[model samples]
Target: MTEVGKTPWHLWVVGGLSLLWNAFPAVDFTLTNLQNDFWLSQYNEEQRAFFLGTAAWANACWALGGFGSFIGSLLLLLRSRHAVPAFLASAIGLAGVSYYQLVQNGETLKRLFGQAPLYTTPVIWAVLLALIFYARAMQARGVLR
Candidate 1:
C-alpha cells in the first residue's frame, strides 16, 4: 500500500504518459477547429473538407474528448480525486466522437485515411478506460485526495 501523504512514482509516470499521449490529438483538434490553414494542410483535401464540415455537436464531443483527457491527466498528477470525474467525462466524449466517426462518417473517413482509424480507435479507448479505472482505484486507496 502507498503510504499516506506519499506519492508513488507510478503515479507520475502514468500521468505524464497520459498527458503526452493526449496532447497530440488535443492540439490537432484545437488547430483544426480554428481553421489554421498550415495545420489543416497536413491532411489531404478530402480529409480537410470532412473535418471542416463537422457538425458543432460532433466538434464539441471531439474537443471534450481531447481536452478532458488532458485535464484528467493533470488532475491525476496532482493526486486529486477529481481526476475520476474528469476521465469519465473524457470517456463519454470519446464515445460520442467515435460513434460519429465510425457510424456516420465511416465511409468518408475510410476513403481518406484508410484502415488507420480502425486500429487507432481501439487504442484510444483502451488508454482512456485504463486511466479512468486507475484513477478510481487510486482514489479508493486513499492515494488521491
Candidate 2:
C-alpha cells in the first residue's frame, strides 16, 4: 500500500511553515503610519527624512521579496519530481530569504535612529527546521516521490 499525493502529518508541518512565506506582504500591507493622524511629529526633520528614505527602500524590498516568494512557492509546488532536493531547497531558501530580508529591513529601518526590532533569527530556524523534517519524512516514505 503506497501513499501518493497524500501528505502525512509531517508534510502539514512543512506546509504550515510555508504559509509564513506570505507574512511579509501581510506586515507590509497591514502597517499604518499613525504619525499623520496623531501629529506628534511636528518638524522632526531627521525622522521625516529617514522615514521617507526607509519607506521607499523598505517597501521595495518587502514588496519584491514578498511577491517573489509567492512565485517561488508556485515553482516549488511544481518541484514534486525532485522531492527531497526541492523541499530541502525550499526549506533552506525560505530561511535564507527571511534572514536576508531581516537584515535589509533592519538597515532600512535604522535610518530612523531609533530602536527598531526586525524580528529574530530563531523564528526562521524553527520554521525551516519543521519544513526540513517534514520534507525528510515525506521523502523517506516515498510519499512525495
Q: Which numbered prediction scores highest in lDDT against the true structure?
A: 1
For each candidate, the alpha-carbon lDDT, in order, equals 0.90, 0.48
| lDDT tens readout by residue for model 1, 44-90 | 88888899999889889999899999999999999999999989999
> Relative to the unseen true structure, what is the C-alpha lDDT of residue 30 in candidate 2, on a scale of 0 to 100?
35
Candidate 2 regions with alpha-carbon error over 4 angstroms: 1-6, 9-17, 20-117
Worst 10 residues of 1 by lDDT: 1-10
Question: For candidate 2, what is the TM-score?
Answer: 0.41
Q: Which residue pairs collide in model 1, if any? A: none
